[model samples]
Target: MKVYGLTGGIGSGKSTASRMFRELGAEVLDADVIAREVVEPGTPGLAAVAERFPGVLGPDGRLDRTRLGARIFGDPAERAALNGLLHPRIRERFLEQAQALADAGVTRLLYDVPLLIESGLHETMAGVVLVWVPRDVQRERLMHRDGLDAAAAEARLAAQLPLDAKRAHAHWVVDNSGGLESTRAQVRDVWNQLRARD
Candidate 1:
């Protein structure tokens, strides 16, 4: 199986592109989904998080994402601490899933991670496909999608490496700033290219 890294900034339509890729028959391992699973109720991941950040779990014994987000936002140390606690568990789950998929004879696998480039995981993939959008479009889409004001949106965008900078690391760039059909067309093209490479 050939594994590719799919990444984009928040609101750059990365999830949309991931769905399209999945629809096209590529196995996708989403880091965000694995991250949530690792911390589910009764898991050691959840227990560690609850111990480190008291009061962040809900009455249902689930992680209160909003509370945790608020706690980590604007606090680099807290964010790093959270990453330290969750990343290893998430990676373990991701590798397990990949092995299962490979055992099932899956060919093209896309590791859909928002931080593939930032975390330096792109080096492990066959190639990286970045969903790209101009900075202004990214900021506007983020504000609209997340119901954030311009300032808040910009602050969130500023937290990550800029989309333009990430383009340098990509083997394929799917521009998703235009209409749905246009995005789909680009995704199809990328998919074909991936298959050809395999």
Candidate 2:
């Protein structure tokens, strides 16, 4: 199986491109989805988190994601500490599910990681497809989607690796400036090229 990574910043349309890949018959493993699942109601990951960040739970005993996010986002050391506790577990879960997909003979898989470049996972892919859009567009989209004013949006963007830096390492680059269907067409072209390399 050929495992490729798809990555971009918060509002670069990476998920939209990934959905296009899925429609093209690729097995898509989303890091954010797995991250949430690992810490859900009954998991050991949840237990560990609750142990570290006490009272971060609802009355029904589920992890309060909003509460935890606010706490961690404000404090960098706290964020790193939580990551230390959670990353290993999330990695293990991702591996198990990815292996299952490989075993099922899904040769071309797209692992959509928002922080792939920041986390240095690009080195782990067979190849990488980076989604890119102009910085102004990115900021606007982020502001609209996140309800962040311009300054706050810029701060959020500053947290991750810059789009240009990620673009430098891509095996393929999908520019999302034009339109949704245009982006989808680019993903199709890239998928054909990636699978053909096998």
Which candidate has the highest TM-score of all? Answer: 1
**CA lDDT of each prediction against the hidden true structure:** 0.94, 0.88
Cα lDDT tens digits, model 2, 67-163, are 8988888588988889888889878988899889889877778888888877778898998899999889999999999899999999888878889
Off by over 4 Å in 2: none
Taking the tens digit of each residue's C-alpha lDDT, what string does model 1 give over 79-124? 9999999999999999899999999988779999999999999999
The RMSD of every model to the true structure, in order and in angstroms, is: 0.8, 1.2
- Badly placed stretches (over 4 Å) of model 1 are none
* Candidate 1 lDDT: 0.94
